[model samples]
Target: MMESMVIFHRCRSLAATDAFYIQQLGLTLWHTQPGCHIYDSGYGYLGFVEAADFELPAYSCISFNCTDCAEVDRLYEKFKGMKGITAPRRHPQFAVYSFFIQDPDGYTVEFQKIVKEGEQ
Candidate 1:
C-alpha cells in the first residue's frame, strides 16, 4: 500500500517560489537544502529545486484539496486578480469547485473542494 507522497519540481528563483507558496498559497516551509526547498502540504510535502535552464512542464499540475467549498472560495478570493490566474469555477464533470493559478515557475497549482455524494 502506498502510504506516503512527495512532489518535486525544478525552479529558478528559490525566494520567489518560497514567497509564492508560503505567502500566497499559505503552505508552510518544512525544510531547505542547497539544491531544493520543501513545503508542508498537510498530507504530504512539495519540493522545488534550483535550476538554471528552467523550462515549464507541458502537462503537469499539482492540486490541493480544501476542507470545504468555503475554503476553496476563500482561496479563490486570495488568488484572484493575480497574474496567470483563471476565474474560479466549477468542474461539473469532476464535481469539483476549483480555481487554477500559475506559480512563479509557471506551474499550475489547483485548489479544489470535492463534492461528496448527494451534495452535487
Candidate 2:
C-alpha cells in the first residue's frame, strides 16, 4: 500500500500561495525544493511549484474531508467573506455538507463532511 501521497500544482507566486496555504488554510509546511513548496494538510501533502506561464484550470478542485458537519461549519466561518467562497449547505445527492473557496491561485478548494455513510 502507498504510505503517503502528494498532489502537485502550479502557482505564479510561491509567497502568495504559501501565505494562503499556511496562514489562511493553516497547513504546515512539510518540505521544500528549489522552486516548490509542500504543505502537510494533516491527511496528505500538497505541493505548489512556481510557474510563470501557469494557467488556471476550469474544473480542477482540491477537496478536504472534515471530521463532521460542525468541523465543516467551523471552516466555513474561517473562510467566510473571502472571494469566491460559497455558503455551506447539504448536498443530498452527494451525502455531504460542504462549501467551496477559491485559493489565491484561483484553484477551487472544497471543504466537506460526510453526512451519511454508504449512501452515495
Candidate 3:
C-alpha cells in the first residue's frame, strides 16, 4: 500500500532536533542522515531536516496520542529543565489531557491522552 507521513519541521539544528525527539520524547529512530532523522509514529513517520534557509508558514502542530495523561505531564515537566519548554494543559475541544510544547524550531507539539475503551 502507498504510504505517507508528515515532516513536521525543517529544523535549524538537525542534531539537537533529532536528540529532542529521540532522547527526550522517546520516538524510535527509523533512519538518520547528516541532514535528516526519520521517526516512527506508529502508523507513519516524522522527519526532521536541517533547513537553514527554509521559510515555514504558521503550522497548526501535530498531536500524538498517549495512554496516560499523567505520564505526558511528567515528561513535560522533566523536559522543562531543558531549553525552550512549555507547560501541558487540557484540550478545550475534547475531554482529554493534553500538553503543548515547541520543538527546536518553534514548532508546536501536542501530547494528548484519549479516554480508554470502557471508561468515561
Candidate 4:
C-alpha cells in the first residue's frame, strides 16, 4: 500500500518560509532536517530547503484540498489580506470552490474544495 507523500521546494530563507507556513498558514512542523523543514498539511507534507541561489520556477502551485466549500470559504477570509490572493468562487468546469494565494516565497498556493466527487 502507498503511504503519505511530501512535496519539497527550494526557499531563499528558511526563517521567513518557516514563519509563513507555520504562523500564517497554521501548519504544524512535522520534521526538521539540516537545511530542510517539513510541515504537516493534514493531507500530506510540504518541505522547504534553504537554498540561497535557487531560482524559483516561473509557475509553481501548491494546492490544499479542503473538506467542503465552507472550509474553503473560511480559508479565503483568513488569507484575504495576503498578497496575490483571489476571491473564492466556484469553477464549474473543474467542479471546485477555490481560491489562490501567494506564499512568502512567491509560490501560488491554492485552497480548494471539490464540488463534484471523483472529479479530482
lDDT of 3 by residue, 16-79 (tens): 7777788888888898777888898776788877887965557657678877878778777776
- Would you list the clashing residue pairs of candidate 1? none
Which candidate leads in TM-score?
A: 2
lDDT of 2 by residue, 1-120 (tens): 889999999999999998899999999999999999999999999999999899997789999999888888899998899979999999858788899999988999999987776533
Cα lDDT for residue 41, candidate 1: 86
lDDT of 1: 0.87
TM-score of each: 0.90, 0.92, 0.74, 0.90
Judged by lDDT, which candidate is best? 2
After superposing candidate 4, which stretches have Cα over 4 Å from the reference? Answer: 117-120
Write the residue-wise lDDT of candidate 4 on 1-120 in tens digits: 989999999998889998899999999999998999999988899999999798879889998999888899898998888999999988858787899998878999999987877544
lDDT of 2 at 54: 92
What's the residue-level lDDT of 43 in candidate 3?
A: 63
Q: Clashes in each model (backbone N, CA, C under 3 Å)?
A: 0, 0, 0, 0
Q: Model 4 — which ten-residue stretch has the worst lDDT?
A: 111-120
